[model samples]
Each structure stands twice: as structure tokens, then as C-alpha cells.
Target: MTQLSLRNQLVTVFGGSGFIGRYVVQKLAQQGARVRVAIRRPEEGLFLKPMGAVGQIDIVQANIRMPMSVQAAVKGADIVINCVGILHEGGAQKFAAVQARGAEVIALCAKEAGVKKMVHLSAIGADAASGSRYAQSKAAGEAGVRRHMPQATIIRPSVVFGPEDDFFNRFAALAAFAPALPLVDGGHTKLQPVYAGDVGAAVVQAALDDAAAGQTYELGGPKVYSMKEIMQLTLDTIHKKRLLVPVPGFALKPLAFALELQPLFAPPITRDQIELLKADNVVTEGAKGLKDLGVSQPTPVEGVIETYLYRYRRGGGKFEPRFS
Candidate 1:
């Protein structure tokens, strides 16, 4: 996509203000696409205006949960990308409404509006029969997308990590005060964490390339690390040596329940999250991944963690590395 010419295309990005969504918008802008960032809060995404030339990017209000909103957003789109999956369910944003049903709305509206192509952001664990409702809903969403737009590109990325990511950053913040971090079910569950930027590039590729149509790409990083390994890496990066308690999966239910009862914005953990960690979150064998899409050799966790995690160090970014 060098020369990255997409100036003639109009890309409507749902949830474009989110972590992965923002990166997608930036990459599309790089490709010279006229981007319409569809978000719940259009004003909040005002900062993205500078990502492209004047009048090249616009913000629109849209909620995937509402069919009319989704219809309005994709009315004249050349490409539509749905990066709107949720990890937790609370209040009015249930898994069924937002993930499963909402996905169907997007696909239906896109089809009716005659969009050229679409890309849906799903996770590696999406399964309809899975114990985790979050994963099950995601599977439903994929089914809906396939039903409406068979050629739509679906991307199932393993754990995604970057500066503003929720995984390592959340644990790093926890380590700032907590004496110890829990290793649910002995931390054997594995995760191959891919970089957010890489995923963004993949979405952009799906948008511009007709060959990417009717594809499902499972994206992961170069190495896969177990939950404990990830926790250890987090501790090391932040110059902390907190104890990693080997708590059985069953024991965390009570704690997760209590944590879930906390204010939604400040939740420490949720029961559904515990269920998700029960299984490994890695790319499945024989599946098409980043390499298949020509996004070769994705960035490793070690290569980028130190760049943003230094803020969690005892004395901050310039502080000397501490060894335990």
C-alpha cells in the first residue's frame, strides 16, 4: 500500500475513538482515505482532526446498537470497519445488544447501503459454545457479519498491547500499589500479544485491497507467553518484584464478584474476565495470521514495553533499572 493512495475512498469507522479504533483511523488517514470517525462522542475524537489534511477527516455520531444510527453512518461509505467489541458487560451495554446484535446491524446496514467492503475486529477466543459469554457473543457477531456480508474481512487478534492498552498497563498500574498480583489457575493460560499498530495496519490493508475480501486473519506476535510470564515481564519492566500468588481459578470467583460490584470505571476485575483466562488466548495452529496478510514479523512485547512502561518505575522514566 505504498503511495497509500485511498484519497477517493470514504471510510466509516465505528468505535473509532477507542484504543484500536484510533490507530485504525490514523492508518487510514495515512493511506489518504477520507475518514469519517463514527463514535458515541464525536467531540471527544476532535484530536484526530490533525491526523490528516484539513477537511480530510470528519467525526460523526453513531451507535452500533441502534440500527438507524448504524444506517446513517454507513450511508455513503466506501469502506466500513467495526472495531466495537467490549470486554465487560454492564448497565445498558450488554454483550448481546452491543456485540452480537449490534454486529448484525452494522453488516445489514452496510449491505443495504452497498458499501464496497468491511472489516470486523474480533478476538481469538470467539466461540458460540464457549463458557465465557463474552466469547460466545463475539462468535455470534462474526456469524452475523458473515451472514450479511460474506466477503467482509474478519480479524481475530490475540491480546493486543501498546501504550494505552488495558492488559500490561492495567497490571503495571496495579503493581504501583498492590503488594501482590494473582495468578489465576497457576497462570498457565497463554497469550500471544500483538501490537495495536500492527492490527491497525491490517485493518487498513483490508480496507484498500480487494484481495483481502472474504478472509479471516488470526493475528499474533512472534512469541507466546503464559499468564505468569506476562505478569513477571510486567513486574520486571516496572522495576517491581511483587509476589505472584498462585491462586486457583475457583478461588478468584469471590474476589471477582466483589470487584465487579465496584464502580464500573474503577473495576479491578470481573467474573467474566476470570472465565476468559481459564483458557489460553493464543493463535490457533493452521490459521491465517499476520504473516499471511504480509504484515510480517510483528513487534515483540520486549521491544516496546520499556518505551511506555517506564512511567510505572519507582522514580519514573529516567530511573536506573532495578534488579531484584
Candidate 2:
């Protein structure tokens, strides 16, 4: 479908200050949409203002956990986008509360407001039967959206990567400091990392096209890489050669439990995350994906990862390649 003008359309993007949300907000801004970035802290998303004209973008304080706040955010918007999700359960942000119930609140509010288009962002491994709480909550969120607004567009993107992403950069940071990087479950779990921008484009496209209504699009990248391969690729990008140590998922369980017992900076890997890697995170065969929405070939990881990972090289940014 050809892109339609979003010049005067009001789009309320929940979690618009996040990594993927920032890209989505920028894409919507590019389409000349008046974006209402509804996040918990309006001040945090101040950076998004420059993406659009003087008054084209606005950030209002709203948390989906609170239905009244979400209702107000979607009240006058023409379209609503929910990208709010949490990897770990923090104080008041449990997986069921935030990912599942929060999604329900947003969808209900959008429906009540009579929003024309609603785009809900989910993950590829969102299955209710999955052992992982993250995946189960995501699946519940999808069900919530469908129940509230039958026509809402659902996008299940496989591991998104970009400059500001956690997947590549986290592994790269590990390579820079750690002598050896652990390959959980022998790093056999397959992942198709879709570029954050490509996801943003697909998301904005869904919002603009009427054909996307009542559809679910599975977005993936150009190629698939194993978990170990991804770690190796990150090390290669950062000009490092760290030993890839094979670590079984079961061995990490006790450590994850101990860390959860006592607070630290951030747990290296949560138990739920470990459960998630047990299954391949890729687009399923016959599932509607990027190409189905006019994105013939999504951007590859190499195109964007090296640009930022280079910062983690042994030397500074201008350092010559060690083994290019």
C-alpha cells in the first residue's frame, strides 16, 4: 500500500521515549504527524521534540498501569500505538500488570476514544503456553488488544537491533570488559534481528494503511543468526576476540535466582529471559511479515551495528582495525 499523508493526524504513542519507541516517534514525525508521546515522564521525552516542528510533537505524562491516565492520552487521538513492555519485573511494573494489563487498558481506552487506527507492538515468541513469563504476558497483551479493538493492527517483531538497542550493544559491552563471553545453551537459539528503523517503518505503515486493520504482521530481518554467532559478530564488530564459553541454561538458574533475591545494578540474565532463549526467536514460516506490508527486504544488522559497536574497540573511535 502507498503511504498516506499523516500531516494533521494525532498519534498517541505510549512508551514513545524507549529505544524502539524513539525510532517510531521519529518515523511518525517524518510523516508530519502530530505525535502525542504518552510516557510516564513527559520531561524524559523532551528529546523527541526536535524530531518534529515547534508544536508538532508533544509528550504528556501517562502510565498505562493507570487506566484514567491512558484514557486521557487516547481521548482525542486519531491513532494510538502501544509499545510499552518490560523485560524485568520492577517495583510496580510486573509483566502481567504492565505488558498484559497495561495493554488491555490502552486498547480499551483507544476503543472508547473511537481511535481510527491502533497499532500494538508485540514480540515473535509471544505464546500463552510458553514457560517464559515475558512471552506469556506478551501473548496476553495481544489477546487484550484483539478483545478490545478487533481491528487493531498487531506487529510481532523479532529481536529488534539498532544504535540504541540492548541486544547487540549489551553483548559488545561484555566483549569489551569480559575475557570470555558465555554462550547460553551453546548459543543455538536462532534469532532474526530486525532493524529498529525497519520496525518503525512497518509500524508507521500499519498506522497509515487501512489494509493493515485486523492484521498481524511478523517482522524479521534479512538473515538469521544463532545466539553464539550473534555474540561472535558483536565481538568482531568491536575489534575484540573473546573466548566464547559454552554455558547451559540450567547452570544459570541458581545465579539468576540469587541475584533476584538481592538487588544489583542489573541481573546479567533473568530466569524469564533464559526461558525465552530456549525457543528460536524468528518469524515462523507462512506468517505474514515485512514483505507482506511492502517492505520487500528489511535492513540487515551489518548495515547499522558496526557504526556504534566500533566505539567499544580497544582504542578510541579513530583506532585502526585490529583484524579488518
Candidate 3:
């Protein structure tokens, strides 16, 4: 057993209602921290209460776009974590507004409130000079945090997957029903899919480790898999076979932009999301990861897919026979 630490600390987690946020909140609660989940809608975060002991968790409304609310959330907290990011944009929720400006809000408020520590979650492909608005906003968000909280630990994780993840399971479900699955750029884009639980554990480790201050960690799984390989693995795990149709970047990219226009109804794709796939979403060379965060080796995609993807299988659960 590891030495118990960070007992009784107050932590404010922005966007704690999200897929990754729930896991991180639970891990923090297990360490005896008083976790305050800050979300735009507190009711949605009510599910987090069961993860902790009585009075160990609370939920409050704190929209990053509203600096005053963010300030109120950070006030009197020992640690603050920013998980507010958007995969696709909508009204008042563009990549720049939420990812870039909102990140700055949390950092600045935390600094003003004298919060002892902070952690920012960013994607793996963050680059200031990148063409994708998503990547650029992430890079900008990191810069904003550093500007205010120079010692904040920034974590850039590759594609995160788990029971609630929309990555592998969503694609697997689609593959189960669709006649053919499109392989963007011949599905050559490399990725290192990390488990959401592992990433959450990394957050707990970083928030408590003073030595991790001001450092950046790039997290990935034990093995790297290409887009096509991941898709195939998804199919194999769900016991479905489908044709892999290669879609050239030139032809498929324009459609991606058209998908971006979907935010008007539902953001099927954003210009930034399309641009993000042009490059591999994996860890950089020699970057600190799970090992540095003191998390055990993350579960590989192969080991985890069946646990959740079973629901999407044709017969129902993994135990259900195909012909039955």
C-alpha cells in the first residue's frame, strides 16, 4: 500500500460531469480529498456523489466563460483542475472560447484565490503553430495556464478510452451496423489510446506531487495502434467484420468541413477536429507519462475494449452466442 497523503484537501474540478472528469473526481475522493465538482449544470454531476463517502463531494455551477463563477469555485480550494474542453463547437462554445479563453480563466482565478495547486488536461497534438484550431487552442490554453500558474502541472493525453468513452465503442457500434467503414487517410494516423482511469490516476498523482509542479506530461497506452488497426481491433472485439474503405484526405477533408457546420444542429465534426486527424495523436518522444505519474502500466486497448464494447455486440453481451 502506498503512503496515504493529500488528506482533507479541497479540490475544485471544472467540467467534472464529463466522461474523464467523473473518473478523476472518484480517484481524488478515494484519497480523502473534499471534491467540489464545478460544471455548467450541477444536476448532471449528481451521479458523482455516490463515488465518495458522505459529505466528501459537492457539485456547483461554474461556467468557465463566466470569470466570476470560476473565481467563486476556486476560492478557498487547495487544488483546482481544468477539464473544460470541447471536441466540437456550438453556440458560445467554440474551440477558442472554451479551450483557450476558458483555460485562462481557471488559471487566473486559481492564482488570485491562492489555490495551492492546479492541473490542466490537454490533448496530445497541442501545437501553437498548428493549422487545426483545436490543437492551436489547446496550445494556447497551456500557455494561458503557465502565464498565471507557472508551477501548474499540464497533462497532454492521447485518445482516452473507457466504458463511457465515445472513441472505440462508438466506432465499433457503427462498424457493427454499417456495410463499410471509411478509413480516413487509409487509416494510417497513429494513436496511443490511454485508459480514462489511468489518466485520472495520473491527475491525482500530479496534483499531490510537488516535484511535478511546472512540468508537462504526455500520456499514452502501453502500445501504439494505427487508426485502421484500431478500427479492425474494434470490429474484432465486437465480433463484427466490415469492409475498410480508404478515404483520401483530399476528398474526405472537405466533407469533414461540411460536418463542421453541423454544430448548428449537432457538431458532427468541426474544422478543428478534421484538421486534428491529419497528424498522429500519440505521445511525443521521451515525454513523461504514466510511469512518471506513478500510475501502473496503463491497460492496452485490446485488454479493455471487450469490457464496454460488449453492449454493442449483435446479440447483446459478449457471452451471447452469435447464432442465438
Q: Which candidate has the top score in lDDT? A: 2
Runs of candidate 2 with Cα error greater than 4 angstroms are: 2-4, 318-324
Tens-place lDDT per residue, model 3, 187-272, is: 99999999988999998899888888889999999999988999889888888889999987677767767765654454344456
Could you give candidate 1's per-residue lDDT for residues 122-194 as a string of tens digits? 9999999888999999999999999999999999999999887888889999999999999998999999999
- Cα lDDT of candidate 2 equals 0.89
lDDT (C-alpha) at residue 125 in model 3: 94
Order of quality (lDDT): 2, 1, 3
Over 220-282, each residue of candidate 2 has an lDDT whose tens digit, in order, gives: 999999998898888888888889988999998898887776765566678899899999999
Model 1 score (lDDT)? 0.88
Each candidate's number of clashing pairs is 0, 0, 0
Which is better, 2 or 3, measured by lDDT? 2
Worst 10 residues of 3 by lDDT: 315-324
By TM-score, the better pick of 2 and 3 is 2
Q: What is the TM-score of each candidate against the true structure?
A: 0.95, 0.95, 0.93
